[model samples]
Target: MSLQTWLVSLFLLICVILCWSVSAQAFAPYPYDSYYSGARFRRGPLMGFDGEDTQLQQLMQNLKPRPTLLIRIASSLGCIAHIHMATAGEIVEVNWLAEHINDPHVKVLDATYEVKPKPNWEEFKNTSYGKFDELIKTHVNPNYTAEHIPNAVHFNLDVAYFPGQYERFSFYSPELFEQYVQKLGINKDDKLIVYSRGPAAGMLFAARVWWTFKVYGHRNIEVLNGGFNAWKSSGHPTESGDKSATQGNWKAGPIDKSLYANFDDLTNDPRGGNLFENKMSAINMLDARPGGQFNGSEPLGFPAPKATGSHIAGAKNVPLPNVVGETGVKDKSALEEALKKAGFDASKSTVTMCNSGVQASMLALGLARLGIKARVYNGSMSELALRASEYINSK
Candidate 1:
């Protein structure tokens, strides 16, 4: 790990031990749309690490993470996820998932989260099915009604992983997650393939769900590259049926900590905050918002008073609009070249932060597909903007 990362991890340990009593804020819920353009977000207190227990930590060690600046353990909801740095996972090619479309035992999950809220209720009930075929039949959107992934289960990454205020988008309670997986008839043995509508919206939902499985101890989950768009773009087959997939006896295992970000490292550590200031060298803060926003074109209600940072001093700007225009960032060669030409190291870690965590997820996903090491700063631009006040003056 870099010197900044080491110090941050150690400092985070101190923060968690000394201040482990605050409640976690709600995650930006799915159907995760409400991008209040000019919305300003403040960094909350440390998100905390559930390191009092070592069961999860052991699993993380098993992953054998390389010593890098991205290693962090995110703690929340009484559990800890050993979140590696951004751009770290095995990013399956956008078109790669389609190669195995004919596998019968391979189950596909459709994370269709709708906002069917009552008249004035700030919170709407989120209904996710373990099976996507059923959800397709109960189709709400005009686009999805046409066709859906066969034998796919409906996993609502939107509402299942919501926080308190953002309860609609926080992580699902362990009980709810297990019940949802079982309801979809997914067991430990079945390989799970997850897909969504588009790149940013859907792929992010897909990744969050993938992380969920790791938390629940399911090992064979994969995200369909480019989501439904990539499949259709390649003329892949699609089916619409209520054919329920059978569920195996899959017992929920302890959370594999590798998927979490250490709240301490994220908040209290010197490296965590210094990353905002390390724009000159050794660190790159990628902004996934449209160039308009990054260049100060205020869309919506953003450009917060504190969302100020030097774009990592010499950091290159890679707008999501360019990467995944219309469909998604499926072209691997193009993405790799983009980073190479931009002077980015695929093996080096990066922190993907967008308006919230969603767009960042897309960038992170794109980076991962190109084998670039990146991680989503789930706190969103709200957190980053707020944190930036310490460095740059937004006003």
Candidate 2:
């Protein structure tokens, strides 16, 4: 009764202890290297067998899980990193604006401008003087100023450039931009909501402002979907006269080079010949001009009155209207489908171009909302046609 029972009990206890030890090691967070499956580790002194270092193991254990909505961006070296993408929530709707209009932290900007026939001092003066006033009074509403959007300040695109260089749509100088920043009273933390007269107009004006703010390092900027026309059509009230903004402490931050492209960048490889023909280039040049303009069937406007029109050789034509509808930018699935049909590869880096930089910026913004990074060629065809005439001139 005593010896046989004691031997059997002792053996069972030993077997159970061994099984528990194996199971605990299998599920333990520290020892096993399987957790770093997709991660690539560099050879360093801190690395252990299978590249799992004690410090790294401790750090991983202490780190909290990433949010589901957060996107993980990998570096060129294939290391996981984090970056923010502009979401649909970043885009303000008319109803949201109506509710938040009076919020002190929310600043509204009316980015409306009439397309001038030519770039001359007289035209500029006339347009600036009573033309804008009449536009607000007549075209917009008698009770409102040409820059009407109810408690909104006007951001004149005309103010973006230095006085004499009217032909080129150059950004205002740093000093000038600083003054304009103060005039807008935008702080680092303030939320900016920009709108234009109509959808198409907003794409040109409001989106441009949105890009400018992003370039200057402002983070909380948004474009009003459907724009002011939608706002008015929704029967919202309008305000008359111009409203001035208080001085803000905002200063220009580092320019986001990824968001802009110039002629030199476009013409980097002389052997590549045309801007679009550079296969070695990382960027895909997208012509956002109208079909007629892209196909050389239309005339170049104003400044280059006699220059025949054509797109950069090898560029894919993706009309701006196709990406934007009556409301705002189309939904992601629709945009992806349209872009695919237009031969745009979302996987490749993209550079958007149009007659002027405005439409190009709109397309860039649209791409950004889709989590695709893009650059805008601000000079676009207007400057390109004049500079790279050999490439754009029709035979």
Candidate 3:
């Protein structure tokens, strides 16, 4: 072949390969026909060609790459980012939160609380320090109140509790929530950031507050990634003694009942209902307790149960540690995998419960990160065992 002919052939081959590669990347899966249809082709020439050759070459060169594979996959599966969860860095990224700390529109809440078995004051005293103390002070004395993140207001988880009842902890009523809103000086449109002590302790407390805000129609809210533990570990400044927030006008909106689950929802009836027999296929129950508790072995120091053995019938045990690690809730992919392995169905409704409904919020928070709306059973096993006679060992 002549040298000129050989050069021309090589140029055409290169163009063909480029065009093929571009085409392959642009084609997305089903239900995106509109995406493909709306894509436009640019008119231009390739290798300085003209007329028919120019037209063909232009078509090849004009083929643009489509949205990235991640975007396409997200679109195909109808994936959405959950706005309710935030990482430690995300809150502090570029000093975003630091800059806004003094802003009237930004409010930070410390939702730390002490959770120990009932009738065990010693256990409560032992468990309340460390992460819990750093986030918020549950008790006050002349010596000191608990330390907390700077400029953070307090939201006592105790307000959500009602002891000696079938359902010990219930969602705070609108009137009570309004009192909180007024006390915290938060507006409906304000950006609220809540944090706890750790994944096992304060994180769940933070999640419960996050859930409460959501139930009351507060959309502008986020949970701190690793709570106060992560904040202190990062060497952020802290303050001791109680800090009062400026009073502001904040009102409660309509309640979103879907964010919470009561004892009746988890059982067939008020008295000794069988969880498995009454189970709704649409709703999956997830127990966020340790394996021992899930398998019917009560942990030492836990209150003697009115009825004990196993988790609620039909409950899937997904330990809190599996979803949250030393740093924080595991990355999104890891959390999704953990849930799937535990037989969680993203398409179905999920109800998370733990010993006293504290750790369960961590699991719910993890699910929320993946854009799954999970309802928290506030009373959880503590109330369930007392109210229901039936318990089954999943082991």
Residue-pair clashes per candidate, as listed? 47, 1, 1
Which number leads on TM-score?
2
Q: Put down candidate 3 lDDT per residue, 38-147, tens digits, no spaces.
A: 34444232222334434443444443344455544443222112111222222222145556767877788888766644534344335532233332344432211368
TM-scores for all candidates? 0.57, 0.68, 0.66
Clashes of 2: 1
Task: Give the range where candidate 2 is weakest over 10 consecutive residues by summed lDDT.
Answer: 74-83
Runs in model 2 deviating more than 4 A are 1-90, 117-147, 163-167, 199-201, 269-281, 302-309, 393-395
Q: lDDT per model, in order? A: 0.52, 0.65, 0.63
- What's the best-to-worst order under lDDT? 2, 3, 1
The TM-score measured for candidate 1 stands at 0.57
Could you report the Cα RMSD, in angstroms, for every candidate shown?
Answer: 18.6, 14.8, 14.1
Which tens-of-lDDT digit does each residue in 1-395 have in candidate 2?
Answer: 67756975675555445434443343355545456545654553212224534544554454334212121111111111111223234467889889989998888888886654335645555564323333333333222264477778777666654222323556655555766667667776678898877447355678888888887777688888888888888899887775766788767776677787777767773445435445324557777888887786775553554354466655777787877888778777787876787788756678888877888878877777677878888788777556655456442
Lowest-sum lDDT 10-residue window in model 3: 79-88
Which candidate model has the greater lDDT, 1 or 2?
Answer: 2
Candidate 3 positional error at 154, Å: 1.3
